[model samples]
Target: MSAPPFIHLRLHSEYSVTEGIVRLQDAVARAVSYRMPALALTDLSNLFGLVKFYSYARNNGIKPLLGSDVTIANEADPDRPYRLVLLCRSLQGYRQLCDLLSRAYLAPRVRGRAEITRRMLREVGVDGLIALSGAGAGDIGEALLQGNRVQAASRARFWEALFAGAFYLEVQRYGQAQQELLVSETAALAAEMDLPLVATHPVQFLERGDFKAHEARVCIAEGYMLGDPRRPRPYTEEQYFKSGEEMAELFADLPAALENSVEIARRCNLQITLGKSYLPDFPTPAGVTLADFLRQEARVGLERRLQQLFPDEPARARQRAPYDERLQLETDTIIQMGFPGYFLIVADFINWAKRNGCPVGPGRGSGAGSVVAYALGITDLDPLRYALLFERFLNPERVSMPDFDIDFCQDNRWRVIEYVRQKYGAAAVSQIVTFGTMSSRAVLRDVGRVLDLPYNFCDQISKLIPVEANRPLSLAKAIAAEPQLKARIDEEEEVRELFDLAARLEDLTRNVGMHAGGVLIAPGKLTDFCPVYSADGGGSVVSQFDKDDVEKIGLVKFDFLGLRNLT
Candidate 1:
């Protein structure tokens, strides 16, 4: 195939914690619009978007260059992390990249950022990897700008030897004065060191028109004013998805830099397998099969429950036979659907909680509708006695894993979690992550605060937005529905700017947070399927994917909720 003039190799999707503004769907659409064959996602320091990016790119017949802009510990100033660009050249590179990511995040906490030391690169092993001298903010470029050409050259040679055949000098033309200096000095350094030059357009948003909203997002993250000159602007409006011809002219004299982006695109081919369940194996008794073991325990529990509920033989005859029939039918459906192990695991944990004297909730959610749960002692509610429909729990029409919402005494929940952690292995358990988005109401308040408007003024205007506990109105919808909101926007220029900008900013994620009780028990180490990060840089590890995403990848979520009323 003929070489395309350029391809975007440095991009920050929405997953890049607070700075990037490009949505995954919109990024794919822009690639299609340009008729470009490939694009890359280097979201901050994590591959949080890798699975979605790879699948979407391959499905749309576009190649995805998988990589990240890693924040490595600075040798000179350990507190300040130095940015470095690393891309995967093959599946082996992806694995090594994952290894590096896990170690850095799991390391002891740092005040500002998570990072791996530059010296540790050898141990991580850059076997099937490609390295880039990152943007002017990166280690090498910063060294050059500080007039330390020797240190910059030494750093370049270090990476050149580290990545072996795959190191490239990255030159980005984003309209900075230092960029020209970086290019001139880097071109000389590249020639001397025999490194190839690759051009990358540092993309933060989808289009040029999105600059205002993107800046506002950066301000919200960094807590700066739009007019604040103390903080330097790291990007320009020119950093958008550019066409091949537009980039070709940007580097007309050094065409090899543009051509090498296409070359880098050709080297990356990542395939992510989606939708496979990774449930752990329940330890069955020495001789029994998992299905038979579950059946035996459930039957024994049923007989004990039967005797307690119906003491007289005459009552046993009336109740026992029907309860036995319901148990058998539910057990048959569970085993046939290959969920015997699922049931056994849930029972083991609930029984352990009870043995340890934790007060467990009787039943909650659709799983309460199953007689199997009652017989296994996972739920105390009797389905037949309560007349709860078994079809609602595990329908013959829809065969899926049944979820049980278990509640432990609020104080004892951790002991129960500690027991499970010890039983299943700590590496296998994690809390799920959830995103906090800038909702319609939230964006108005945030934009008002940063714009330095008065609290009463912001509140009075925001109150015009009609919202409910479950439902939220979009800014446009609010303007249409409320005459007062519409009149304020029509008459006041500040109000109009606030409304316009807030609308663009709404639905962008604000921060990462923990799901109250959605704990995922992976079959093995979670890195086998996805990445994990500490919530707020401490406490339990969280799956980068949220509850919905966790289910898609086959990690069963057990909600061990805490109830306020119980407290």
Candidate 2:
């Protein structure tokens, strides 16, 4: 293959929250249409979309460069941080990047932004990473924009020395003020310092047409009116994803900048293993394998359970035959599936919860259908008595991780979670993240507010969008269902713009949240599987990927849902 002309090195997806308008699926499709071979997703401060992006890109024959657009604390002014894009070239680089990103969220935030200090960069030691100067928004770009060549060069040298040969001075042309000057100065600095210059589009949206929607999304996020002069309008329409030909034409005067983008893409060869289980090892007695220990525990526990049901030894003997057959079959299946450790781990925590007087629910989901679960006291229900099929929980025919929805008393759920954390190693366990998107009515309200539309007018239009069974209609569906809503938009230019803007921004991720019930127990440090995030400096830590994504990456999600009635 004649070297792929150019690759996008700094594109953000919806995981960047309101700042980016590009969805992973749409971004990948756009790249394929452009005939590009590789693309990078450098979402702001997190690899929240890494696994999904990686899967989609690889499936579609595109190289996936996993990275983050991280904010680095400015030494002189911590509140004013400079943006930097760091892409992983190896698994070590990935882990280090995860550590840095996790630290940024877990540390005290500067101006509500997740940022790492210079000290953090030095301590973490960047290896197997390809660092990009954040174009016009980076430290060097900021210095160059301010006519401080010395400061710019000094900053470039620091990164160059730190990243070794993996650092590149980034140049972009988005019609932003001083961008042309930045490109020229960055090129000179690159030559003077013998550093490489790489080109990027800094893509926020998929196309130029989505610019207004992107701006409205930002306005909604920053609580600014679209017409407000004081609002920071940092992005431009030209920041959309451009074809390689377009990028080549734009940077024709400096061809190496374009070539280096391809080179960086080629160099970033990180591979992530997906769809394989990474179960944590359960502690067992010496010389006892997980399978053997599990069988021993199940048999002993079942005997105690059966003894209660059949007080007479003769009746117990008759009952024991069937129970013994069922137990052996279940144990064989569990061992065959290599889930003896998983069962042991779940039982350990559940038994602990029970012993400590924390009420756990009878059981929920398919896991209640397992005879093994009943024998081990993971569930209160007896599978055979209730005629619940073990195949529903685990089947030799269909191989997948067995999921159990476990409920604990609302007040004491944390106690059980805490126990699991300590048992499995605190760093190995974390709650999962959830993305909250802009809903239909809420999107209209936000768009209208930013558009400076009247309150009752916006409220009336929003009210016209109906809700059914607590699920609001999508913006498109709402417009179709309510003819009045469509008519109002058709009649008034302001209403048209409001609905137009709202429609585009609808269903875009607006905020991050922790999953209420889902928690992950990794085989090692959680970062080895996925990055962790904390809203507060040092409270609850959550996996950056949500429940579904975490499961795709092979970290089993254990539901520890809280129930008030169970209290």
Candidate 3:
């Protein structure tokens, strides 16, 4: 009915590793319902949701504020970590944010949560970034609550000097106890220091009632039972996405904070270019372009293959011109499309695996249709003999990444990954992170337990859920397909309640897992493109972005597939 009063400037959309429960799509829907013009994603220690959040926000008629709730190294005490909310004001700001987050993982230190030191931050330099005096639990706010106002003021001033005019004192009122006290003290300090103020909602879920399901998510993440106060329980029900009016009323006395959020949203101007193909460069010899090198290699390999495949001179002669013509045609298409590097890169790894006695498949999928692949030893198929279409592999019309699903010997795939890391620099390569969303049956078990329903009861209801042949059906679809599930829902009230809650909690992120074979390689250290994360601070380093978004932002994905049947 009226102009939106405020915009949410701090939100964690499941990309906060284990802590966030809101999916980016659902968060956007909630923001749309609030009729707000802008929203922000400040996922902890990573920008995993940045590309998708930004793209989706724009598509949904909202300005997306880019920020992170990064865990920073406490310079005075390295053992203790402090969290800060950093938001970007421009393209330069986004780059700085990426560099800062990248160094957090790249630092030569013992593995733990990814963190960058103040010294590292200074080296990277905060140019277009806006620093927030992280409201409650932020360095400044926590220092105030801990009765270390001197430290709080020092920290605030340090950020103010670093951020220059781009800094603001972040005030949030999420119905927490010490929030008002922190806000009052921080506001007076900001006035004394001439720092601006901005209000944030710090959302974790779409609605307040989703807290129980969110709690189940936390328990599922940390291996804790509900009410297990000994473990980390950092969020409250108030962390839900509040309406702009609700937030404005919460900080009614300090409208300046609310207005400043709008100002910050206005300053943030990010333009993400989607659907562009970004492949990693494969190093060629001096004075040789990848296109030229690939052409030379494929031609020689094809000639040698023809001699071997057809031992008779007359038979080989018959195959020669057609094979050469097909090879030239495919090569032209690849070179014209700017994908010679992609072909060369795939060939190198496959050849590496084959040389080391690791079984490499001839080729699978549409890639089998290319004669150039047969020449390069990337595939064994003779496209001419099979009458396979070259357009299926590298179409002149299709504009997408030419995905070569290379299957390596099941056990030796790790060696290939390690080789890539060593050659490309460990920081340049990372396995893609895949999220495990709470599925229909899964939510029934999780929410059922949280609601203190018996295990047998939960299991019985879950078993009634149908499993389709190709893809699993949704709860609604399953209920429609299975009469037993419908009958149970109609007969028992507890069953109806469980189904109700499970349906609501379904599709929220439950856990993080490594993608089966998807690995991302960058031209430089990956943090320049996207942040990397780990399962327990070490071991397999995974790209924070998933399969689709990983490609959307321009990091090339190479699926190093492993199949026993291929061998």
Candidate 4:
């Protein structure tokens, strides 16, 4: 297909956490339907949705431009920082972008927001990146709005010098106050500096009607009523996904700006390697390969376990034959799959936990079916006695990464994590980050509160929704299951509006969190594989990507879950 006249250079997916409502699948499908040849996902400061976005775009024959809408520290007033959109033009730019983002999160945050400084940007170097002045939120635009053309000009010069020929003055026409002024000033500055102009629509939702739902979502996050005069309204309904023709018409006066969006898409070509495992290298004894060391350790461990099971010599001999066969079969499959190091790494940590006086639970999950795990003491269950098939754990027919859910005494789980961090460099180890989404019942309560409804009334309506095992049923299912909920929706106009808005906002991310047990150990620096961020309230360093995305980018995840009963 021929390239569309204009492409989106700035977009925020649902992975933008609470601020965006565009799902990656929906975004890519829309792009394909519009016949756009390429699209960019510049989620706010995080690359959490990048791998999935890239995969979806590629599978749909759309080029994926990887970028981030990052906040740079404004030295004059640290609390109010400036934003810039950085797009990767090559693999090296991707790596640099990851490093910069990791450092931003690692540094001391201002008011709980991660930011990088001008010096940090230069130190990291922008070798293969395209910079877009963040339009109204950018430093230049902010300065111009304040009637300080000198500061805006100075900021523009610095960025132009830093990004060289790759910097573009971004312009947007969203129906916001002073937007026309910013646009005219930006165009003039671009002309004065001889910089290219690029048009972008800061997409937060998929359609125009999603604006109110997005507003309700923001109110829920900020603890404010939707109608409260004090509440901030930074977003507009016009920020939905627009076709290339709409964008071209929006910037018709300066056609070059629209053309530059497609030009930037052509420049950014980031190819991600997926579906491969990158395991941390386990140190083996001198003159012994990883496979040999694993075999030696498993054999010795099995002999010790066998003695505990069978004291009589004749009984031991009779029981040993099948155990030996199972161990050899499992070991060969593990080695063939190039996962000896993975098993060895898991065994080392579990053994360390045991030796350090921390109570460890016998293995859980499909990994409990492995004879090798039993031999290595990674699991206490005897697969042979239970007649568990090793194939259930690691099937030679269907190759996949083996995951063992290890439980430790809740109080001592952090000790195991620290031990792993020391054994593997700290830069190589990080906790996985998880996103808390708005559930059906919670969304209903939130929408009601934001709408200034009576507290007891909202609570009454919410309680009618069915819950199973402490998890609230989906609104559709709950409404079907409960006649009271259906009656309220059908009888009350306010109730119906609340339900309709809640349905649209439900399942979108509401907050960030750390996964209880999932931790990643990369082969080298974790930043080399993916960016890392400090969790909320200044907690441990966490991977920006969650559990599934980490594996998709080739990082192996190990679970070190804590169980109070194990204590």
Candidate 5:
């Protein structure tokens, strides 16, 4: 039995949030392991993991397919629920796809759910693109299942006309009996309409055995008791990545469907590149360069600050030694580092906040070590007076972003954010996202609940595990450090099983929340650089990447942190 020639067109990576078990690198490695030359990653909707996927796949000798699973409203009936899968075949197609997805989310009425209209797709659908009549949840499949084959065929024709030769009837065999019937009907319909057929298993994990862990993840996402009979369980355990051979066996009766997967993979040639940072031009007053403007502001600001601090000093003494030579050197270093605009932009916001009667902190972090920042009103603390080194803040020894951790009064933080949105178009500014992982304690409790263990018993076992807030303790580390925990795990089979499952699920992203104060301001719409997501029920827009990932993509993240101490 030779391996079946097939490539997975609908695969989810870890960026699919809790529902996806395969990491991007792991997914690419799995494709290479299986000898599949190409693979597609259609994670939910956002392309947050595209760069990682593209780079990893290319470096490891595998072709990367850029695709998205986008939700759109039905044309005739606006309330109908369904989504379409679109894949890019060229750079232009990828850009158009991005534009469509962006509009789907940015539209005023497209709140809560990301959705586009069929009309919008018709307008934006370009050449060299492929459309997969989605699996069970797709518009055509739903209509077919609802005894509306005519409507289903009609919808298929609509897409067929829009996508021309780039459309295929998608078939999946996840052990669902309805899927078998749907596949047969879909094949017959395709034969009648002269459309191509493609096979995909809708992979969510690396292998079959991972289903249990994936199920637990699903339970975590739904906030459901794992053992609760009423909770909705996955229709099949076969959602794992099936090798080409497995897919061939599954679709043995329809070899073309299996072969079409390879054909589709060959057709998709989109490659994502991490472009240069698009930092907005900080608006300087007319007739002055940003550097000159910043210097002028700093000079005047320094004199005003000195006057306030030493009002009793004679005018002659003030004029004799007005500017600190060391401070001027620090300013030169800042300007030379190409951060004058960054400094000016930050200072502009802080000044705007202060002028509006919003309380601002003196300063936070190593940014307090810059007299240049002090003079520019980016920081209020005089570094010379505090005996702070400018090198510690800017690090001229090694080029790096000069981060000023600014604090604002809690009551007026949003006003400052609004000012930024107004100053730099609303599309240019956004907050950063942070993922909450299942910590050691959280995993223990969740696993215990799933196993139906007594709460007090689980609490006792958990209490034995020491709490380390900043530094998390692994099970092995805990066992080595705590005698009681090691003894219990060795003594009881159930306790051991609980520990086993907890250990597996621990440190996985459990939920997403907004960063306390980190905001990423881009020169263009944020989606062009990185995907944006809503944060913490606050309606605050956030980048999908954390602070580190944002910097990796070459975007400067400003921490407009709120401090309660100011209150």
Candidate 6:
């Protein structure tokens, strides 16, 4: 039988943050191009690309190995740090890895340095996990480079004991002289210790030609002059993904290294399954179901609101026949739609906000069209009085989430979030994460900085391109818009080069930040349902999913958007 295809145990994508330039989709495409069966994404320190990687790989008929390049404390001296690459071989292993990574960042420690401890690994590391000694800067490589072969071997022995045959000595050759020597030494040590040696390229780019652009990115990140020969740069262009024949040729002297890669792929059998929402159980008062309680409260509240609005009306005149019928219909609709708890949850905090003197707006969007919301105090506007249709707010004919775009005083919005956190357990509530992409203008600026182009020349060229807020300007569009730009591209090689690199990098997510008022609340612990990230100030947990993806994963997003006008 033909041997299983080689698996790339160590690969990085654009999610690696300036270090790697291959987008996740392009990476999968490249792997498929080579007819590779599976690949692993060990992006630096975070599984930011995990879900996307998994979905793309699976859809493209390639298996995705879920892993992360985590910084771990040095064994001999817990102060020094080095990265260790861990891959999940089973569902439990994936969960264990998530827990380890979560604790590594969430626990109190030094500001910038986040490292997982040996104690954490022992406690949380599950069975069916494959451990790889990371590339040149990894723990074992650092030890070996320091000429401490015994220490490196000792660490290997410890990992072998912890993970048994699941631990492999990961050796990478990126054409660096040091990496060449380290790989040879590591392979020898693995053989001596009866451990397998796996070969990897430490892939950061998809093609050799991408090296220059990737290097420019590195310079931008390190705040260094690209032309300066003194700046530390990546060892070589050999860091791009290579074919199986290329890997075989590179490790021809030690065939087992290439063979071990296939073996590792055969051994790893894990897949990350997207989970359902874990919405918290909305507490019901004594002798009343959540649905019943919501209806009772909304009805009583609506009557009081009508009385306050028309206090001078006689009782006979106040007995409007339609008011009670509308209330009953809205209440029945809300309960039947399985959203009584959702409405109550939204109303509770809104009420709390107003009571505490926090300014709340009348309403915005179709949510203002709900009479029940006006009754429950979820909104200040009267739908009946304003001639707003309830169907527009809660379309029974077309089922959709009841969205209330609440506007709160910007200054006191956090008070509302704090109240929600207090009412629901802290683990149940969190902000949604959003990413910022490098747009056409921004990418032009980045490339110009790296190419060392004159500031005014770059600014003038950028200004020539017409600005479109929603639609970014393409190189072709820019050429069409400005005759001078086309002339510069045709005449100057450097100008062309800047545009070429910028075009490639544009629209790539450059950084991540929290969404302003999009909070997701679950019925159970969020970590059980989805991954959570601690906010910058360590104040709140943020879901890794964006607004739309959060809904796809079954968590409804309630946008308690803060508006300055509310103040």
Q: Which model is ahead, 2 or 6, in terms of lDDT?
A: 2
lDDT of each residue in 307-369, candidate 5, tens digit only: 866777786366435247766887788788778888888988999999998899989789888
> Model 6 over residues 1-567: C-alpha lDDT tens digits?
342346788887777675777899998998888888888998876677787888899999998888888888775766667778888888777777777776676765544655778888898765757888775667778778888989888878888888877887888777776867798788778878888888877888888988887887777667776788889865489988888778877778778878878777777788554544334577888789988998888888888778876776786256545667778888888888777888888888888988999998888888888878888898888777778888888867777778889989999998898888888788778888887777777778888987889888788777777778766587678788888889999999988998888877777767777898899887776665556666443556678667766775667788878898776
The alpha-carbon root-mean-square deviation between model 5 and the true structure, to one decimal in Å, is 3.5
lDDT of 2 by residue, 341-419 (tens): 9999889999999999999999988898887899899998877788888888899889999888899999999999999
lDDT of 1 by residue, 346-446 (tens): 88888998897888888888888887788888888887777898888887678566788888788888887888788889888888888888888888888
Ranking by lDDT: 4, 2, 3, 1, 5, 6
Error of 5 at 443 (Å): 1.4
| C-alpha positional error of residue 131 in candidate 4 after TM-score superposition, expressed in Å | 1.1
Give, for candidate 2, the lowest lDDT window spanning 10 residues. 1-10
Model 4 vs. true fold: TM: 0.96
Q: Can you give the TM-score per candidate against the true fold?
A: 0.93, 0.97, 0.92, 0.96, 0.87, 0.90
Candidate 1 RMSD computed on C-alpha atoms after optimal superposition onto the true structure: 2.4
* lDDT (CA) per prediction: 0.81, 0.89, 0.82, 0.90, 0.79, 0.78
What ranking emerges by TM-score with the best candidate at the front? 2, 4, 1, 3, 6, 5
Model 4: CA > 4 A from native: 1-3, 468-470
lDDT of 1 at 18: 74
| Tens-digit lDDT track of model 4 for 491-555 | 99999999999998888777878999999999989988899988652358889888988999899
Best by TM-score: 2
Off by over 4 Å in 5: 1-4, 51-61, 74-80, 90-113, 119-129, 146-148, 253-255, 273-275, 303-328, 395-397, 469-472, 535-538
Cα RMSD for predicted model 6: 2.9
The candidate with the higher lDDT, 1 or 3, is: 3
Per-residue lDDT value at 478 in model 6: 78
Tell me how far the alpha carbon of residue 41 in candidate 3 is from the true structure, in angstroms, after superposition. Answer: 1.0
